[model samples]
Target chain A: MHLMDTEPLTKLDPSYSTVMRIEGVLALIPLLIAGIALYVAAEVPAWVPGIALAIAALVLVFYLPMKRYRSRGYHISDDRLRVVKGVMFHADTVVPFSRVQHLDVEQNPLERMFGIARLILHTAGTHNASVTLPGLAHDNAITMREAIRAHVKRESL
Target chain B: MHEWLRVNPLSMAVQMLRTLGSAIVPAAFVIFGAGTQDSEKFAEIAPWIIPVLVVIIGVNLLGAWLGWVRLRYRVGEADVRVEQGILSRQARSVPYERIQDVSLEQKLIPRLLGLVEVKFETGAGGKEELKLSYVSEAEGEKLRETVRALVEGETAAPAVAAAGEAGEPAAEPTGETLFAMDTRRLFVFGLFNFSLVVFAVLIGALQQFEFLLPFDLWDYLADLFRQDTIAQAGDALAGYTLVAQIAAIAYAVVAVVVVGMASGVVRTFVQDWQFRLDRTAKGFRRRRGLLTRTDVVMPVHRVQALVLKTGIIRRRFGWYGLSFISLAQDAGSANHDVAPFAKMEEIAPIAREAGFTLPGESADWHRASADYYFDRAVLQALVPGAAAMAAIVLGYTLVGLLLAALAGVLVVGEYFLWRFVRHALDPQQVMSRVGWLAPRWQIANRVKLHSVEIAQGPLARRRGYCTLRFGLAGGRLSFRGLSLDDARAMRAAVLDSIAAVDFAHLPR
Candidate 1:
């Protein structure tokens, strides 16, 4: 069993890893609070269980972001865009340019600081109607959106 | 021809009633609260009731009238446009070329008033379609025809409203009906559609109006459960011969079955009375429902896929349901059930009309990877198996044993599901068969797919298998648990078909 696709896909921007780690730290704050609350609530409990759990979470908070960053990649061909993402639950998606109904290049404050953006392609399908490719260079995201937009045929859905 | 018109005047009264209905709940709360908390206030308000009622009625009528005056629709040469709203007005137009179909609906009150609602279905899912309510039935039919004619491109003459039930397709009255269900067939279908929903409704009604009953239902049940009743009944049963007891049990079972059958028959009669499907110049025109009659048309060319489904009980009786996965999502369902109950032979012609062939001799279907399903079965049963182990650790032997048995059954059932599943793909179409107890088959045109997705979970990655899913506008088609190479190959094949299509030239 091979982990990688036969043709290697281009990896996401390196700074996206930092953004993912920031998100991981944000997720940990609530869990850390819950762990401390449980440690206080439990009668006659040693601090060892909570410490072990915290250590495990701390490891994951640092380790999982890099794993996810490594797993995600995207390839743009002549008429289609294939995006591969996720480490635990991997999904490889391909959207044809002509099928795109609309396009958007969005940037959150965090992404803006990192000089990155997400490109969203809207299609007419009920499920999977929006295919998003995040973690692109800000300028690159705009370029891709314009390129896809040019190929998009505006027809009544 | 452009005709700007307002809806039937009778609709104003219906609108008023609807407005009043929404206000009734709050009004009831206020009135009842006043009566309970302060009798003096209620009495003080009593004398003014008639005047207040009159004012409310006047206001409601004025609003309805205003709405009616403001709402206007125009049938233009190229599109149908509707302008509405009082202060913040909006004008919506649907081009004739974009309309996938037109459906006419009539609820009980509107039917009594001889008015119907016309719906223009587009390629987008059901949510944002166009609707025109409370028009004369004849007007609705004419509008449908004009749209149809315009969509097909103007011909020599304008379409004339044909003579049939609600201006049916121009097909001759003597023309062979593609499919129809008479009372007898409906009865057979009812027998297969066995349900106990009526019991649930009955229980709900009992709960809602329990005040009418002389005694509390809980107290009655408690009384019946008392020792005396059980002992007396046991003694009485002990005196009866074996044959008599068996006969009594049989009668009880028969009674329960009759109740289930009655409910199924009643629902079938209400929902599908006089069901008819006909191939018209427009497409497949389906008409059904007793109280709320609906008329919907799906263009043959617009059908993206075909679905055939059946329950285990119905399948045993050689009954299969046929559906069309068109752009118009029918209510909550993606596939429109064209023939809800039919035999395999009967469904062939309908499938042919939708451009699909059911799996049989000459058709080749490949089995899914054994490791994919086997690993899936093991993974699915792990949760329950671990739960059983925990239960045993807690010293609950009975619970643990039961959980173990359940886990075993799950493994066996999932394995059977995987064994029954098969998939077939060719240059023209892709098809898959899934489910063991109640089999469902979906056939989708390769060119109609909007996008492709290949997914792999941790277990699948280790096992060298992937799941391939296709994005359809109003349906689902997927091949799960394929080897990576096979998945990539299929993706390439489908992508080739999609890339070759010049979507601008295709009809909307």
Candidate 2:
């Protein structure tokens, strides 16, 4: 059976867009301050700050979130879990259940506010030991963690 | 099992001395600078120095005493627990099964005191899992044996414990000498591992203090080169300043190289003096080092993979070094070097004694497809070549041309190196051999592989090729530029081997 051709992998929660937007605004705050400071210090035309603000909004609020969201996906096979991410630089990581050392479910304040969480899988080797799939729904994270733990137990046995 | 035991109280003195030793360098520098000012200034500082030293010693001793009082450890049947930290009260419990290596170390003071420091290395890579410092040598050995027995018991069937209780003859400790390095071999190792960077740095540091020297060596050299001095020496080279300068520089370079080689020799001797690898029924016991002796016990199953490494110089002499990729990061360091330098013929036998075998011995070796040259070309050549062109367009013409030339040279080098990149699969082992400059061959047991990944980048996907990677317990290795079909087949074969091994390990 073709592995990649099977059922489509699950995507992150839709509310992740709102979370990204909030993150974008928070990130853009410093850039916005820097732009205003430069315009005031250098005494450039008023339109330069306006243009900078427009480009920042286009990048942080719209383009980046959409592309990043589109690129992120994860799937679970019988023995392994695969997380595929990155747009220009694509990475597909497949970790077997037997290799998993532990599983962690985390929800930062921002993620908790958005009703979403992240699932992290720690494996044996140092390189690529921690595979994280973020923007998972809170319930989905719990269930997936349980499923993975059970899979590891069965595999080891 | 929960009862906490503290190390010998004398450990506090060792801890305090260690703390003071670390601070002594800075304190000495301060005193030295003060002494250079004037006798009055030195005396002014000297009076306060004693009190300051006393206070520092007192504080360190107090801290060590408090730390010793707070720190406690216990060995449970299944796990080892440590409770430390005077203020925060930190506790850690490491499972016996996860203990990959148990190492015993003895420094000069500790050895004189007949005490040993035992370190437990669990595969987890944060801080060290646990350390029992300044325990009696006998106590340390007992703790090591108990942990090893517990870990072995977990694997070989709990019946091993019952057999022990029934006095089924305590496990035989007939350890064989797998390998040992004598003074001659160590000297050869030192000669081959000669490095000049340390000497160069030292010379540079000395040059920084040239102003502080009582008499200028350069001035002495200039005086020797004076016309009167030359004439007194029979006027053989009265006006040959060019020759004299060249000779002086050449002598300096030779001096540096000689010093560098001597330093390398000293370092190698100190590190690997009387290095020995012993194979006990429990696992491999390695003991080495001249000044600070280290003894480590690495269970056979804990070794993830075996790596045969040879440098360009060592390759000419047919000498290769061997090390194990173990679950513990400590085992990956220089201390785990099983063979400092061994002949090509010696590798297979030595590796066989370990869990894995040397590549091409029991397997049908298949050289990676010629397309691998293209993969290396893209990585080592095309990308850099493109960067060169970009640099040229961006007005860095000279740098771009140099980079372009370097890219060309590497591509040709990798073209020659490509033939060495071969992979083979036996019934139970997977081996990959690669490299030409410092030819390295890695053999990993199929059963130890945690995951197999087949990755195809954008370029490889278009080229119908992929890179296959095998992730073992401590490290991972990959073979690039396999056709998609071959990659898939290898992945399936590896997965099948893993399954078969897992099934074999299952209870009948």
Candidate 3:
């Protein structure tokens, strides 16, 4: 393989990281269980390992999302949509609008609260049939959906 | 075939029998449970048994009758509609344009009864479609032809949508014998397909009929293999003469080999008897099986890729099984096996007919980055090496040494395995060759690919290498650990090929 990097991608809304942090908080429930188990079953004060887990959870809840948010982006070109995401495993996907079989715009309560939505394009292909771009302003997601639908309709004609 | 109609009334009987068939296991369980309990339990349930049996039969009969009465269908000019429901009266319609295929299936009972299940497959999901079962074979064929004619008229997709080649090849005359396997060829193929499925069937049989056996089979086997029993057996074996022990061991080995080979041959003969693949107007038609026969048709353009693979032992004789990766998924496998077992030379022609070219000696092949292999080697060795160290420290010196040796071998073998993984891209297609002893090749037309992805892990991102994955409708083709630049270039090339085509005009 060869080596070159050229990208023209649009970054997602920064607030999406806050949603990830909220999700990361779920990880602490397990830690809480472990702490109870340690107190009931053990004789040693568990502060040493407890601090390590707390620091790791803090990174997961705060620092990691901050870094990951920078890596998530999408680019909609003339006839295709490109989604580039992941910090550890960077995946750059390109899906032609013409191949799309259906489109969906969805929002959860958290996303609604943040005034953002995710636009999903479902293609007929079994692998990666659905390509989703989240963290778009709700209106922006709606606008993108219409743009893609029109492009696909014109192509079919 | 066009009018709104009810299915054969025989379906009600078949449905009731099917319900009764499913009830057998639970009924047996309850009977056994009662028999094994206190003496009074059997006498207590005896009075209610006849009434319970009557209630069960009544319910099954009522359900089957209701289902047969409620189900109705009409294959209209523009769409196929199915109306079913005892109370709500639900009606659903699928446009002729959206109906991708009309297929027929017949399980053992249905086939014996001269009935076939007609299915209308749409593009959305597997078998999430209207089914008309227990129809006469003749009616089923007529229904399939009607749907096929309607679909073909609008899309002109009945013709060859050969991959890798430019434009369409004019539809050839049907019933051309493309490939076949006679009994002798099948025997050789069966030799390499050795399996121990008889043991699975035996266990299932044993579980179902445990009370009929003179001894508890599970308990007897567990006692035979118990720790103390094995120790005693080992001691008894140690007293035997070397020659006698060698002959006993050899006999056991021979017995296992005979059983495996016999079972494999039985399975192959039952599944592939009189196997014949023909080029038909609808697509490639495959007719096979001795008992539960299957006849499947896979359209040409719907074939996304070609997979040529072989077993470790078969590879020595240059035999490969060629299958078309298409939307026509057999019960479990996505591949439509054209030649389940054939030499490379024989498989070439079949590949050619599908518009795919087998890579020649001159075709370039490039492996993943050396750094990638090196990183994997270290990672692979780390676990075993660490385990060996911990084991040795805990005093299991012999096992530790073996694990240490395994780690050493893995470090060197990783590089050797990397040599077998490579891909070559050409003007029209990309072919990936992977695996070690049983090498497999996956080839797909660049134009047929729907999407392209380039992925890089943290280590790969640092090392400037990536994995490239292509989205084929029902097939998989991916290359791991290519130089990032090459990965991006390949993705762009594939995307360009996909962009050049009008997807609307692409065949289903």
List runs of model 3 lying over 4 Å from the truth.
Answer: A1-4, A13-62, A108-115, A137-143, A154-157, B16-69, B84-90, B157-174, B208-236, B328-330, B386-400
The complex in candidate 2 yields a DockQ of 0.29
Any idea what lDDT model 1 has? 0.81
Q: What would the TM-scores of all predictions be?
A: 0.82, 0.77, 0.83
lDDT (10s digit) by residue, model 3, range B221-246: 88888857888978888889999899
lDDT of 3: 0.80
For each candidate, the alpha-carbon lDDT, in order, equals: 0.81, 0.77, 0.80
**Ranking of all candidate structures by their lDDT, best first:** 1, 3, 2
Docking quality of model 3: it rates as acceptable
For candidate 1, the iRMS in Å is 3.2
What is candidate 2's lDDT per residue for B158-266, written digit by digit as tens? Answer: 6466557657424436588888888998898888878777857778976765555445667876888884676665454455587896886798899877877887888
Model 1: per-residue Cα lDDT over A1-157, one tens digit each: 2322455798888989889888888887787777777778775375765776678676667788888889889989878888889879999988888778788889999899999999998876666789999899999998888888778666434
User: Per-residue CA lDDT of candidate 3, range A1-157, in tens?
Assistant: 3221355689888778887787677777787777768767776577855786789788888888887889889888777899989977789888987777788999999888888899998875667878889889898999999998876753321
Lowest summed lDDT window (length 10), candidate 2 chain B: B499-508
What does candidate 2 score on TM?
Answer: 0.77
Quote model 3's iRMS.
Answer: 3.3
